[model samples]
Target chain A: MARVVVDVMLKPEILDPQGQAVQRALPRLGFEGISDVRQGKRFELEVDGPVDDAALARIHELAETFLANTVIEDFTVKVEEVAEAAK
Target chain B: MARVVVDVMLKPEILDPQGQAVQRALPRLGFEGISDVRQGKRFELEVDGPVDDAALARIHELAETFLANTVIEDFTVKVEEVAEAAK
Candidate 1:
């Protein structure tokens, strides 16, 4: 099966409260020297057949419509092959 | 500045309710031929300086302690250089 990976991230201008919270907590946890922690979402779709252009376009549409909030977030879709299990 | 990417996903054996919801909704929205949808989280950390081995290990600790639930989810960390703005 082919895996369609979608990465949804907040726009640079958007304020991310969760990220900020993580940043604040990191220092308390002793993970210093870090800044600008932005959190986002990822979706991995296992497609049944070949991953062609048409499939990709549809996935893009899905990303725009359901996966990401275009007004404040940006997303990208990528296709990958699922590896076979070893004996 | 450097960009550190942390991708957190549910384990293969674990059940993903959110992903299944998306898969079910897709057909209703007329996007067919998709199966086994898995959803996850992505964290983008902008480090103030270089992303060396020491920095990476700390990030890994953060992922384990705060970002991912090691029992049910898995996460990976990747570092990239921040792009320079065009003049």
Candidate 2:
């Protein structure tokens, strides 16, 4: 099997309250020097076969269409690994 | 500044309902061949200085204590980038 990873993050212009909350909490927790924190989503898909360019294209489409909201978020898709079974 | 990325994922034995939901929806959405899906969190920390070993150790502590629930989740921290200003 091949593992594909998709990371979806909010656009820089968008307000990320979740990230802000974490950033604010950091100081109280004694973790300092972190100026910003942005929280995002990561998806790992186990594909049944080798991950070729075509597979990557399809995964990119899936990331753009189903995984992320283009209006406010951006996503990146990459092949993480190929299991021994696939090799 | 440097960008540190912390990826928090559920333990292999833990149930991931959100990932299961996405996996189920994929076939319905005309995407197939994905046998399984796992969802996780990615945090981007923009630090005010260089990301050295000491910085990484501190980030690891933060990730363990504040970002992930140690009982059910695992986390990995890596330096994504160091901005030119920090160089």
Candidate 3:
């Protein structure tokens, strides 16, 4: 089996209101030294069947098509074999 | 300058209560096809002076030491040159 992890983040120059909101709220949480806060999404997928180059490609396609907004956001794709996971 | 993006994700087997809560709440947001929701953090840092191998090493160590809870989460570090960023 293979495990794929996808991360979606806001573009650098894009204004992040969500992040600004979070940062404004952080003082109440007692989290100091936190100059800023940015929220992002993470997806973890486990492919039970064979996951090779084709599977990787499919995951990338999904990321580009649905999971991310290429204009205001940029994303990265990470894949690993489940068998190699530290136990 | 260099921009570093760091992503932190929960371990596969970890019981993600926050994710489950978000999944249950997503029906209100009209987001279909999303069967699960895992929350993660992303950090974007821009280094202006000189960013070389040594700077990359410092960032990695920060990921290891404080940025992530290594027990329940793992992280990936991606580094890119700001000058080379597609504009």
Candidate 4:
């Protein structure tokens, strides 16, 4: 199995109302030292496969298609193999 | 000045209750294709500094002291210098 981390955030030009709302709510959450909130989404996915360039490409496609909005958001993909094959 | 990105995540041995709650909420939020949720946090900070080794180290300290729970969380800090002085 392989573990993948994906993060999706608003484009710089987009107005992030949801993030703004989260910011507004933080004062009551006992969090200080933050002047603003730029909220985003994160996903950790576990896939069963031998990780290779092929796995990277397929997951990236899935990320672009379903996990991210190309127009208003950008995403990064991080992958780690959970188990190493015996060498 | 410089920019920093800090990511805080649950320790490998800990149970992520908040992450689990968020995962349960996602399907109700109309997000499909996800069977589990492992949530984490990301922070972007802009600090006024020349961004030398010292700046990097101080930010790492802040990350350890206030931004993360040392016993239950692990953090990584990334710094980007915003400008440079004439040399």
Candidate 5:
């Protein structure tokens, strides 16, 4: 099977309270020199067959509709390179 | 400032209900050809200065302690190569 990865992140304009919380917690945890902490989502998919262009297109559509809330977030899709499975 | 990205994923043996839910919902939504679906987290950290080896080591420590719950999850950290910011 082929593996596809989808990365979903909040829009740049959106206020990420979770990220801010992490940033604040970092200093308290003694990890300094860090500023912005943006949190995002990643989805890994194992497709049933070869990861051809058609498979990639379908995954992209899936990402647009199900994986991401496009109104507030943006997403990118990538396919991992895999070796052929042993017989 | 330098940017560090942390990719956190659940251990392969762990059951990922959310990912399973997404997988089950896909075919109903007419997105076929997908099988295994695993969901994870991504963290983008913007550091206050140049991304030297020291900064990377610190980020790695932060990732091991706070960015990820090492018990159930595995995380990888990478530093982004950014052009020097405008003066």
Candidate 6:
């Protein structure tokens, strides 16, 4: 099996309240020097076959259409190295 | 400035309803061949200075104590390349 990873993040211009909450909490927890924090989603997909260009294209389409809302978010799709157990 | 990425995922044995929902919806959307799906969180942190070993260690502690619930989740922290605009 092949593994595909899709990372979906908000647009740079967008405000991320969830991340902001974490950033605000950091100082109270004694972790400082972090200026910004952005929270996003990561999806790991186990594909049943080889991850060729065609497969990658399809995954990209899935990421764009189903995984992320293009109005406010952007996503990246890439093939990750399969684990030994999955090979 | 430096960018640090923290990825938090559910333990392998834990139930992931969100991932299951996505996996079930894929076939309906005409995307097939994916056998499994796991969903996780990705945090992008912008640090105000260099990301040295000490900084990474602190980030790790922060991740463990504040970002993730250790009982059911696992987290990995890494320094990511900062974008030119962030430099």
- For TM-score, the strongest prediction is 2
Write the residue-wise lDDT of candidate 3 on A1-87 in tens digits.
Answer: 566677788877888887677556545554333355556777665554555677677667767766688988888888744565443
Tell how far residue A3 is off in model 4, in angstroms: 3.3
Q: What lDDT would candidate 6 get against the real structure?
A: 0.93
For all predicted structures, in order, the TM-scores are: 0.91, 0.96, 0.53, 0.60, 0.94, 0.95
Q: What CAPRI grade goes to candidate 1? A: high
Q: How would you order the candidates by TM-score, starting with the best?
A: 2, 6, 5, 1, 4, 3
Off by over 4 Å in 4: A15-39, A69-71, A80-83, B17-37, B80-87
Give the proportion of true interface contacts each model preserves, from 0 to 1: 0.97, 0.94, 0.19, 0.13, 0.94, 0.96
The models' CA-based lDDT, in order, is 0.88, 0.94, 0.66, 0.67, 0.89, 0.93
**Candidate 6, backbone clash total:** 0
Q: Model 1, which residues run further than 4 Å from truth? A: A82-87, B82-87
Off by over 4 Å in 5: A85-87, B85-87
Model 3 Cα RMSD, Å? 7.0
Residue A39 alpha-carbon offset, candidate 4, angstroms: 4.9
lDDT of 5 by residue, A2-62 (tens): 7899999999899999999999999899998887999999999988878888888888889
Q: Given candidate 4, what's the lDDT at residue A15?
A: 82
What is candidate 4's DockQ? Answer: 0.17
Tens-digit per-residue lDDT, A36-84, candidate 6: 9999999999998788889999999999999999999999987887666
Displacement of residue B16 (Cα, Å) in model 5 is 0.7
- How well is each residue in B1-87 modelled by candidate 2, as lDDT tens digits? 989999999999999999999999999998999999999999999998878899999999999999999899999998998879636
Report each candidate's C-alpha RMSD, comma-separated, in the order given: 2.9, 1.3, 7.0, 6.0, 1.4, 2.0
